[model samples]
Target: MTRIVLALAQELAAIVAVGFAQRDEEVHQADPATVAAADLSGVDVLVVRSEPRVLNAALVAACDRAGVRIVPYATDAAGHRLAASFGLALLTTLEAEHIVHHTVPPHREPVCGGVIVVWGPHGAPGRSTLAASLAAECARGNRPTALIDADSHAPALAMMLGLTDDGPGFASACRAAERRTLDAAELSRVAQPLRATDGACSVLTGINRPGRWPELSAERVTACLEIARGWVETIVIDVAASLEEDGEILSDMASPARNAATIAALRSADHIVAVASADAVGIARFIRAYGELRALVGDTPVHVVVNRVRTASLGLDAKGQIRRTLARFTNVEEILFLSHEPDIADGAALHSRTITDIAPKSAFAAGVRRLAADVLGQPDTAATAMPRRARRGRKNKPAIADVAGVPAQLG
Candidate 1:
């Protein structure tokens, strides 16, 4: 006994009536405007015409939540060919009689691959560096990886990777998604190849200007991420640092804002890497931001990473002290520490390469690799290496240190 709601025009109503009669299924008529607001708890199918904007992201999401399959009807009274334009299944008058008898599978959300969102509080916590490193490490394996520069405020991923910012990157993808035409192929075209990584990684650069943050609507960003999941095995998103929603009181819930992209990414992420610098100010800011981060990514596993760890910042027993502080203040038991190596970092940035590519043996690279391995549940052989002293005679050089027993393997 299939229960269906018919929200079609006058001419198509008769066809749906006959179809339900022939199939012996229960049918209820609803106004096109009221269909979205109507209760569809017990309904299995929702037959709507292509008029009055029946098919849209919100309506589709509502129908999916109500366990209803939306079937758009294309008839003379409902503006012919509208269904085809919207990429919806068109039901003609002739087929309406048997459409109710056809078995349509329940709407199943597409399975997304591993999605890691690197986020942090305000201040440069090396979020972009860690994100790129994680993506590069994932690309080292057989699975394909994509690195998205979602920082609409300061879009430097293109500059960081030494790629041209003129290409149609993340903003373009969001536009395509808003038009409901973003597919796996379209995403592949919008994502540029990271040439330095030998095509192992694909990068979707951020906007060229900070003021263009409004271009990335939350809905569109979510849609783009969905399409990206279909195109790659792993995705690493470099999100904005500030997560505060300042305009919530004055702005519409669906309207795009500066934090919309970051919030959307956090909501859609499988895992979140919350990064914080090892300095005192960074630690304080992260502590204040942790509650908000947990609220945004409820029930999602968050891996805390303390970037740029150094003895000068946190004293001799830096790791032990930081771990104890975090444990005492918060419930975070495990924290990954990435060493502060300015020379290696600057060298990689100068050459437009990832830490893994330019200095694979560096502590920063080793920490990122270990983090990736932990995320993927794989054993990390790089952690077994022994630390070596930096070459003598280099001025303003800090001693190479080991992170979690993984010695720096500087080339």
Candidate 2:
């Protein structure tokens, strides 16, 4: 049975109070003695108005001790600071039925999703394409995922995937987050749905112009991801290349910076995917900036991805040579090589589709599938044996890293 305690507007609270055990009692916590006497036993949720006289820190702490959730009702803009700071924001009671079904349960743990940030050093290293492909592959495995473009500089996901910016983008999410009103159902409504041949996912496009970078503040982005984690299974975010701190030179450290979004995404990520282009210039850039990355995200496991591996740039045995070069400078455990293949990537870009949808059989696509498998923590066999059955008298071979050009159409 669901347990609740309502203390907001009487008639409004009664809307959801119907068909459930109702307790018409007023509990006040003006002082320590009153709070000590107040009982919150047998209550899973405590819905209260944002009033300083009634819902103070002491009462909130008492609810926490009793394992009772505090949810605000009819909370205004001024009250958001006090109400949102402590309230779970998971209960709608009667307004949103879907939220109640997804979040409000008496006997189950709330869903906590993993955040994956795709980051690369300064220079084009195929971050956007890899993020989209990974999201598609995760969705193919029946995990609900959302692809987010948090890249502030040179945001190009909308044009790459042929999505319109008229709908709510990442900026809207940040605004909603700042107000502490962003929820899973609202997120699902705002995000653009992406459907592939075999699976489907959601996409939150980035800002259209570089001038809109201020919209994605660090605090708001963190708040948004926190709300999303309660419902989504996976969130793949594509962030900017530079991870350097923002507003360093500014006397006022509180001033907003354009790089805040990228920094926030990196800081909040459960795991990170660092895409490094396989070339002299690309490798040099990765080597130079990787140290800063380590300092910024301490103790976070970063999976290395060498993109666009071509022997033309670095003569024969490119994979072995690149691996040796990285081993000399950085203490990396494993490297996932994603070779350049233009046909499939170009085809997907032309049709505004994911590489997983167009090039399901190519070595590049297979590599993406393997990366997805690694992220999901399933056996290598889960991706080794292709989900699709092979044609008669033909066996599907494992993915091979061919020294070729990485497609730039979608990258």
Candidate 3:
């Protein structure tokens, strides 16, 4: 008897389960949410609906890697084409009928890996820097990391890493994902590769123009990230702050999802790194949005990061004060405090390099490394501070306020 996992649309699932039960197959039904994560292990086959609620492309590819064949059900000829587009064998209507009547020894699922979405409330809370730095730091552990700029409102990874935004980028990747052709090789081709002294990462630059946000439709963005799980160990995404589903809910007609990219990233993430710009205004903005973010992620692990931690804003024991404020309002259990380092932020932007690449031993870099360690479940052996020579001109450095809320903007 073959072990089969069924992940289909709810109503369709019941019909299929009854039809496919009498066959010599051990069948188990999985929730759509569970299948979205692609956690298929010790299963021989995975049956799914064509163009499933989740990105079926990722599920199909993941199953292929596990030596499992996907038996996609398509009521019509178009459904078969959609399955074929994802590189799965075409299970024609007739073949699907045969499988329904009898058992077929084909199909499997995958062990999806880390997909971390770094997000924050608007006001330049260091989302881009944290995403880039986290990817770079995770890469230092010798795992292939991909840093994606999914911030439709303000795409900055291309500029921060000094990579060109001219060529095929994340938009191109999304198009391919929508077409169900975004395999590992295609993703590698579209993404610009960034190599640092200690590690390297693949970069998927965001849309060049803000108006081009429509290219990142929820299905496309979700599919792109889903297919991406097969490409690397760590996939770090920088997303916009807005979580409002206003565009989706307020209209009777199907409206364009303005914040779809951000929403999709949050929903697809295995872990979330929520950054806040450690200031009165920044904290207030975060507190207001915390509830909405919580509602969207639904039990996904969230790690709060208080960026630019300093006495200028919150006074003595700034970390403690901020912690109390957040505890009073939100459900943030553990907080990671990053020191205010304007010099490092400026120097990196001046050189168009990542923080670790420019000042690997800086306190800011150390904090990012720690965040990466926590996300990757690794040890935080990052250097505490830069060498004396590397810290030259410290006395002549500008005020932290002058460059506050700058890293996410610059790097």
- For model 2, the run of ten residues with the poorest summed lDDT: 401-410
Evaluated at residue 393, the lDDT of candidate 3 is 35
> What lDDT score belongs to each candidate, Candidate 1 first?
0.74, 0.72, 0.75
| TM, every model | 0.73, 0.71, 0.71
On TM-score, the candidate that comes out on top is 1
User: How high is the lDDT of residue 214 in model 3?
Assistant: 88
What lDDT, from 0 to 1, does candidate 1 have?
0.74
TM-score of candidate 3 to 2 decimals: 0.71
Candidate 1 Cα RMSD (Å): 9.0
Q: Give me the runs in candidate 2 sitting further than 4 Å from their true place.
A: 1-113, 386-410
Where in model 1 is the C-alpha error above 4 Å? 3-42, 45-64, 68-113, 196-199, 249-255, 384-411
Query: Residue by residue across 1-411, what tens digits does model 1's lDDT show?
Result: 878777877676766577556566787788776678778899888877654245544667788899887787665522333343234555654365545654433453232336899998888888888888788888885567899999978877899888878889999999998786776678788888874343478899999989889988787898788666646768999999878775666556655577889999998887899988888898888888998999878998888988777778889988777777777877787887776667777787888888887877666677877788777667766535533343222334332223644322111
Rank all candidate structures by their TM-score, best first, as comma-separated numbers. 1, 2, 3
TM-score head-to-head 2 vs 3, winner: 2
Candidate 3 per-residue C-alpha lDDT over 1-411 given as tens digits, one digit per residue, 9 for 90 to 100: 667777766776676668664567677788754574666767777776664334365565677677665676666544543454454554444233455453443562221237899999989988898788788888884678899999989898888778898888999999998876777788999999888767789999999889999899998998887667757777999999889895667664466688999999998887898988888999999999999999999998898888888888889978778877998999675887777767788887888778877876566666676677777776555432445663463547432211222232223
Q: lDDT order of candidates, best first? A: 3, 1, 2
